[model samples]
Target: MAELLRNYVAGKWIAGNGEGTLLTDPVTGEALARVSSDGLDLRAAFDYTRTSGGAALRGFTYAARAAQLSEVAKLLQAQRDDYYAISLANSGTTKNDSAVDIDGGIFTLSYYAKLGATLGDVHALRDGTPANLSRDQSFTSQHVLTPTRGLALFINAFNFPSWGLWEKAAPALLSGVPVIVKPATATAWLAQRMVADVVNAGILPAGALSVICGSSAGLLDQIETFDVVSFTGSAKTAAKLRAHPAFVARGARLNVEADSLNSAVLAADAEPGTAAFDLFIKEVVREMTVKSGQKCTAIRRAFVPKDHLGAAADALVARLSAVSVGNPRNESVRMGSLVSREQYDAVRAGIASLREEARLAFDGSQVRLVDADPAVAACIAPHLFVIDDASHAVRVHDVEVFGPVATLCGYEVATGNSRLEEAQAVELARRGQGSLVASVYSNDDTRLARIALELADTHGRVHAISPSVAQSHTGHGNVMPMSLHGGPGRAGGGEELGGLRALNFYHRRAAIQGPAASIDALTESTGKVEI
Candidate 1:
């Protein structure tokens, strides 16, 4: 029998009441573990963390909490090889893909550690300059931000269990808030192991970090008005959470990063042989194949000039054909399976729906695997579709396949003007309702600037690639810690991970109105404030 994973809650490791959900390897269909939280006391867990854990964490200043984060990062770095192995078995990820989650998590923790040091010993931060409230200037209003007197509950996706946990935990911990993580059940092994390691190391206070690795049945019921919930998954799930009684009636804060059909555009001025055009092809292929194109920010829509649609399709197909897909254990395989069979079926279904309007430019369904069975393994070949007329394609814009699939769409150029083409591309991208990111490839500085500005309101980040920055630019799907990572509208209308900006979500801002001397004393004090 495979080991049953245990939930870490209320300073103890406990098993659920009955037979739990079985977790299997996507590539080989091997049973890995079982997980459940059927009988756990969630109300007690929340109360303990909020009162005991929250108080202990809030007792430390920002710099002291940052030191603890650095130690946690170091401990994870020392054992990352084990994490890589777990990721391969649980997530069906190649070595490179594992690095993106494991290493990315460690790096985010370290980045926040260094950033938090600059905050010094302050517990509450000054929001802005004080304003005079009275005519004599004797009274003033001073805005300040302090940590919420509650815990942070994280509901993460299966694609990135490790990074998803730490990316939110780093800021919440730095801001003196405890964290309760509930990783997706399909790939919860890595997240459970990481929490066990940190808890055993005693780097954090008891109940400071916890993981519940099964059904999220009663987790939201324990939340109060001061608590925060962060979720990353499908937009359908996000809507349900928004309408949950905890958020609607109790006023608990919720931040969501949901489904996004991010796009990439090739400039009209760049022909087939130009450097800008080549760069655009490379970026789109990288985004589609990376993590089997499971990233929320992956480019699902590729827009090019209508005149060069054939050339773009040929280049993309050629590049995608060279990619090898199978089990990640095989060194020759460039891509691996989806997180589960359910996701594989969903991706195939999404592709079928897109075919109603777009032509199948490249069919990878018959590609040979390196070392896995095509019938049993969840591996899928990279697929490319071409929509000659993007204006009529509804499913292509609205649907996200969430796998190694991309649609190559063409934007019309009726006026023979580059400016008009750029506008058309932006309009097509906006049809997705909203997105996490969009990249524009152009050597022309004026065109790149115009499109980027227009895309700002819809996308959280805009990546502009030219020959000048091609060598140094991060890939379009790569979410950096220094930049924002969420978008508006269909992308979930939330913000996260822009250096210090992430801490804002975990804190509560209040304006203190009092005498000028009293306000000055509040700002000058370096002591921790008891909640």
Candidate 2:
């Protein structure tokens, strides 16, 4: 029997009371650990954070809170190798994939730390300068962002456990909001372990951060109007969370980063052998194989010029063919298994759904494993579906396989008469409802600019790449702290990162109109001691 992973309640690490649920190793199909959060005092946990955690964090200035984050980042980075080893067993991700999550989390912490430190010591962030409202300038109106008087509930998905938790926590904590993290049950061990490390380091204040590793029963019921909830998962789950009575009726804050059917396009003017075309193929292949295409930002569809579809397909086949799939523990393996057998089955179901409107461009059932047995390992080869008549392929747009899978759609270029105009490409991209990102590969300055603008409303981020800038481009799926990373409709209309803007999720903005002395007293702008 695997040892039970304990949940951190209040300030203590306590073993779950229920017969724990088993967590399996993806590559070997063996039990790795057991997780549970039964027989826990749900109300007490929330209250502990609300009182102890929130109070302690509220005591610090923004810069002091950020400085604490820097300490946590340094502690985690020193032990990153341990996280890498653990991820190899549970996630079946290579060192590179683990670094993207583990290292990326540290980087995010540091980024937010620096951002907050630069703001100096302040209890509240003042928005712009106070405006003069009175004719004599005695009265003015000012806007300020202040931390919510409650805790933050972060419910993250199975993939990128460490990164998901840290990315949300960094901002929430900096905003002086305590956090209660509920990681997806399957990969909660990593999150639990990371929290345990932070606790052991004695960096964060008591009850400032907690992780519960089991069902979220009664969890949503505990949230109130002042609390903020940030979720990362499927669209369906995002909707359910958004509809929670506490959020829907009480008006609690909710920021959801759901999986989107993001797309990448090849410039209509690019020839088959051009650098732009080659970069497109490389980007797709990388997204497909990395973490076995489990990233929320992974490309789910590729748009190519009709005349160049065959060439693009051929190039993709060559690149994907060379990818070696096996246990992530093997140095030779390039791609590895899905997180677990359950996730493997889910991806299989998604693939079956895709077959209704598209043919298999790259067969996945048949593949060679480098250092593992295909019969027992929870692994699937990269899959490519070709949309023969994209105009009517509703399933291709509506369905997302959420694994190493994508649909290829063709849009004809101008040859005296352009079969598919840039407007049509934008229309095809919008069929996804909304997405986290959409990338355009084009050399035509006019066409790319129009496509980018048209896509701006539909996607959280728009990435444009050509041979001229492709060399320096950050690739199609990369998310930066300086940019907004959420979109509308199906992708969940929430925003994150974006520098100081991210702090908005954990803050309340209010406008005050009053005399200058009163305004100065409320915001402490007159230097009568900061709030």
Candidate 3:
């Protein structure tokens, strides 16, 4: 029997009342651990966090909370090697992939720590300059931002267990809000260990940070109106959460990041052997292979000039063919298995759905493994499809195959009319309804700018890659803490991680209308104010 993973609740680590779900190694199909939250008193957990945790966090200034975050980052850094080992065994991620989640989590915490230090010793933030409310200027209205009097409940996805937990926790903690994380059960070991380490270190207040490793049953029922919920998962699940009574009836705050069919386009101006064309091909391959295309921002659609569609497909195939897939422990393997057999089967089914609408350009289903058995290993090779005409292929735009799969679509380019080509590309990209990001590759400054502007409304981010910034530009799928990471419409109309902008989600805004001196005193005082 595998060890049962304990849930950290109400300031103590406790085991569930029932036999838990078993977690396994994807590459070897070996049982690693078990997780369960059965029979835990969630009502008491919520009360403790709201009172003891919320009060402890709100008692500190932004700088003090920032110091705590810095300490947490240091602690994680010291144990990063352990985290890497766990990621390899359980998540089946290579060193590079592990870094994206483990190291990325620490980096985000450190970034927010430094950002919080600059906020000085204030517990409240002024929204803007005070406005005079009376003719004599004796009275004024000052908008203020303060932490909500409740905790933040995070329901993270399975793809990024470590990073997803910390990314949301960093902001909420810095904003003086408590956090209770419910990581996806498929890969919850890393998250549970990280929380246990932090709690045991006593770096954070008791109940300030908690984790429930198994079922999310009755978790939403514990939420009150003042509490906020942030989720990252499928759109179908997000819809169910939105309709929950906590949000629908009581008006609880909810932030969702759902399915996004991000795109990458090679502009008409970037002809066959140019730097822009080469860069486009390189980026698409990187996005598709990284984390086995499990990232929400991965490029699902690749658009190219109609004349160069075959050339683009050939370049992608040649590059993808060189990638080795197997167990992460194998040094020669470049790609690893999915998180589980369930995910592997889901990806294969998704590939079949895409094949119905597009022709298979490169079949990776038959690739040889590096150091793993085909029967048990959940490894999959990269697959590339080409859609001759995207206008009628409904699945090409609608379906998001969350795996190492990408479809190549062509946009017609009219002779001597670059605007028409740009417009058509935008139209094709917009078919996603909304997306996390869209990368437009073009050396032409005007064309890049025009397309980027047109794509801004439909995408949370527009990554315009030119020759000048080719070396400096980060990959399209990489979500940086300094930029926005959510999308609108079908992609979940939520926002996150725009520097200090993320703090707004955990804060409550109010306008204080009073005498000028009183307003000034309220804004300038470092003392805590009642929420």
Candidate 4:
């Protein structure tokens, strides 16, 4: 029997009442742990966060909260080796992949800490120039960002157990809002250990951070009007969460980052064998197999000109062929298995559905494993499918396989009778309804400007790759804390990160109408003392 993982509720590390759901390793199919939040009191958790946790954080200035984050990061980083070992055994990611989550998570804390420290000892951040309420400028109004006097409820996805928690938690904690993290049950142990590390370190105040490793039963019902909920998962779950009575009736804010069909385009002028075409292929292959293509921001669609479509397909297929899949512990393994057999089955079903409109350029679901049992391992090969008809293949655009799968759409360079415009690229990219990010590879400045401007309304981030930025360019699937992440329509119409802008989600904006001299007490800057 595996150890039963405990949930940290209201400053207590407590176990569930009944037998819990078993968590197994993807590679070895061995029982690693059991997780449950059964019989936990949701009301106490909520009340503790509001009273004990919120009270501790609310008294601190922004700079003090930032200092806490820096300490927390140090504590987490010091124990990274232990976390990586757990990830290697259970999280179904390779060594480097685990670092991307564990190390990347600490980096988020550091990044936000630095951002917060620059604000000095301010309690509220002023918006813009104060508005003169009266003709003589005796009275004025100033908008400021203050911490929300409520808790943060986070529902994270399974793919990123650690990064998902910290990315949202860092901003909320820095802004003085306590956090309640509910990680997916499938990989709850990884998340549990991370919270346990912070709790054991004793850096954060009691009740400032808590983790519920099982079902969030009745928790959503406990949300108040002022609280914030940040969720990452499927669209179906997002819908159900949106309609929760507490959320709908009380006007609680919900932010979602759903898995949409993100697309990447190869420019028309960047023909076969060129650097642009080569970069597009390399990036597509990397995105398709990394974390076994479970990322919400992974490139699902690749648009190429009709003439170069064959060459692009051949290149991608060749790259996919060279990838080694099996147990991640194997020294030679280039790619690892899906998170579980259930995920493997889902990917198989998605690939079957995709085969209706697109033929497999490289099908490796039946490929032999390098260092693991094919029958027992959750190993599935990377697949590349191509749709010859780009304009009308709605299935490729609408449906996301959510695994190591991508569809190649052959698009036309000419629109109707004209051929010089770059609208064709944007048209093909927009078929995703809305996407988190789109990568456009072009050497021509005019085409880059044209496609980027056209796609701006649809995508949250448009990554235009030229030779200049390509060398140091972060790939298509990654998100930076300094950049704005989130998209319109199907991708979830909520923005999450944009330097200090992400802090706004955890903060409340107020317009105070008063004399400038009196407002100086609230804002950091000197406001008309002479008046």
Candidate 5:
């Protein structure tokens, strides 16, 4: 039996005649499905959105749109199992990881739905007794958010198909705009499957949602003003996309969440056998192996006291080695394979480059795994690198090994304000290497607060983990609806908050001043002309 992949456009299921693109099971390397993007109506899809679908979406109020999103969330929750089965083929992730990506996406939709209903204004004006000039005078202001006229183009990474698509789409929908999702070729079948479900539900208006499974096909060149384009991939690709003629000219709200050298720093007070040490080891290993370390927010660097570096590295390797790797269907398998052979090769190349500034503390190449089909299996074990020169440009920061690999950097601090003291602290700060998220394990409130503020000005978000207050549900891979997700510099200075902030990106803000009644009427509807 062959898997059928369908594209949703103008609120209908449309099939194409393109040759099938193979979809393989990560662990066993067997064909799970085949997808194609040939014959897809790229131009027609855009036209339909701008003309028909965009009008329908814009016809609804923010509260009405939120109600629709809540309904879709319920529909998706019922189909959770179908999504899980398909998700297993891309990466043999455990049920928990899949839930975070799949159901979490649904939760994100629900969250934004509630925000849309409660956050926006309801009425026009009201009379008040206390006035600046007269007793009967009234003052009023309304915060009205309208959808941007152009479409929101989404360029998604392959790791979490469901989360990546929904995280971008939820806000666009809530803001009364249409979306065009472009999923990466390697793992797009999972996304295709989910979109099929959404289309079948028949809630979204025609042209309101569209999907392109293959090349962006000159879509980047067509973006116009008030449009938003978001990409989740490498910095190199992001730079290229940013340089697109349309993006440069229109400055269409481009949001790029690129891969970076994120890190976790352990304080000197955290020693072995304590909760902090255990948490450190768990965090490092989980980041290295989850989705085969394909996450953009995965920890790339581990910083520890010079004395604890060896112990921490060894503990990390030991934890990783015990994680069983095989088909996710097997209950014992804790880790899975990379999405494809090409991704595995790229990760391997990155690990090989670390020889310049770091040494392999524990080699994953020696680890054993069972692959039924070696030809199709793109499998590689986790690799660890221990950094010696914190200032080294290439290995310490420049390169990002997007796989089950990590580097451990150690630093020694001296008492008082000496040159060595400055060097040690500076080295840790530099070791961050343009990260998306940097975390510190410490119990000292004063030091934690200082570090949080210092890194906040530098990194996107700083996590100060202490025994007193920490949530298991929180991880580097997770992006909350309230906070900005992207980091500065190498991580791509763009964001996706999935809240009012993300919604605002799809619209523009302008202030008009005149008589209060005229301003209020103009703000509500443009149909009422002053003349």
Candidate 6:
């Protein structure tokens, strides 16, 4: 029997009353650990956060809070082996992927630590101009980013569990806010281990962080105006939460990075013989196999010119078919299992629905498995759908498969037609719009620039990939610590950037204008006022 992992709340380890849930190795299906919160009380957890944790965290200056983050980063670095051990229970990660998820999260903290130190000190005061008869300057005022007087709630996804928790936690903590983390049940054990090490290291204040192992019942109702709710999961759940009366009526900040129907386009100019063709094929396979295609940013839509549909689909299938799946610990296995059987079924169902407007280009469903207890391993080989849309069903466009599955949507792209599809997708994405990001490719310099510019207008950020960046992990999973990560329409219009911007999501930003003298006085500027 593996050890049972517990929750970390109010600075100590506490077991909960709920019976322990088993977590097994994705490869061997052997029990790795049992996670539970048998004695943990959600109400007490919230109370501890609101009263003690929130107050203690707020007591620190932003800089001080950042210092805590820096210390915690070092502590986590030392305990990464412990994190890795827990991580193996949920397959689909290589050493490389694990390093990015775990170390990458700590690096985000380090980045923000430098950001907080370099930004400014508290209330040395900003300068504004004098106003009123030479007494004050015009349009001069001081601006200081202040911490919101509320708590932060993070409802995370199972894939990249550690990254999902810390990437959100780091900035919120650095911003002088307390955090309540609820990890997905499938991989919550890994998060439990990581947080336990941090709390034990004593880097965070007693009330700085709290963890909940199960449901987040009744927690949202308690949130105040300045409190933040950041969620990383399905769009459907985000939509339901965004409509919560308290979020709308009280103006609470809700930032969601839900899964989107993200895409990658092949440039029309690239002939079948060119480097771009090979690049396009490689990208599709990589996105499909990485983390067993369990990423929000993974390329779900592959858009190519209608003329090249056969070639693109065949090449993609051939590449995907070659992928080896088994235990991630096996050096030969190129891909691993989905986080759970529930996820496998969801992806399978989505692929079934796609057949209404698409056909199977290649199927890996019959691929061999090495797991002794294959059912318990919860593994599903990658699946591909070739979509030829005669009539677009809302399900095909809106619902995400959430595993090693995706669709290739062919489009006719004359200069005139390209303009129409981009426009249509954006409009559709906005109303029921959903996507985290989109990329467009074209070999013709003018056409590429045109496609890139047009897509940029609609997507959060557009990547114009050529032969060079095909394998770059530059912006793969969560948003880079500095950039915004959210979609405009059905993708849920919430945002989560890594540093000060992420911090601001937890707080409110207000613009106050008045006479320069009064503004300067109000702002409490110390040096010669800039305004």
Residues 1-531 of candidate 1 have per-residue lDDT tens digits of 788999999999999868899999999999999999999999998998998899999999899999999999999999999999999999999999999999999999999999888788878888767899999999999878889999999999999999999999999999999999999999999999999999999999988999999999988999999999999999999999999999999999999999999999888887899999999999999999999999999999999999999999999999998999999998999998899999999999998998888888888797898898887888899999999889888998999999999999989764654455667888999999999999999988787887799899999999988888988998899889999999999999988899999999999988899999998898675433322
Ten-residue stretch with the least lDDT total in model 1: 522-531
lDDT against the true structure, per candidate, is: 0.92, 0.85, 0.92, 0.85, 0.73, 0.70
Per-residue lDDT of 112-194 in model 4, one digit per residue for the tens? 99987876776667777678999998898877777898999999998888889999999999888999999998888888999
TM-score of each: 0.98, 0.96, 0.98, 0.97, 0.90, 0.88
Q: Report the C-alpha lDDT of model 3 over 134-199, residue by residue, as the tens digit.
A: 999999998888899999999999999999999999999999999999999989999999999999
Candidate 4: segments with Cα more than 4 A from true spot: 415-420, 524-531
The lowest-lDDT stretch of 10 consecutive residues in candidate 3 is 522-531
- In candidate 2, clashing pairs total 0
RMSD of each: 2.1, 2.5, 1.9, 2.5, 4.6, 3.6
Clashing pairs in 3: none
Judged by whole-model lDDT over C-alpha atoms, candidate 3 comes out at: 0.92
What's model 5's overall lDDT? 0.73
lDDT of 5 by residue, 380-492 (tens): 77888887546444556778888888888877755676523324533556555556787777655565665566566557777777776656537655678777777888788
Over all chains combined, what TM-score does candidate 4 have? 0.97
lDDT of 6 by residue, 118-189 (tens): 544442223333334444346643444456777888889888787888878887887677898888877887
Q: Candidate 6, residue 238: CA error in Å?
A: 2.3
Per-residue error at 409 for model 4, in Å? Answer: 0.6
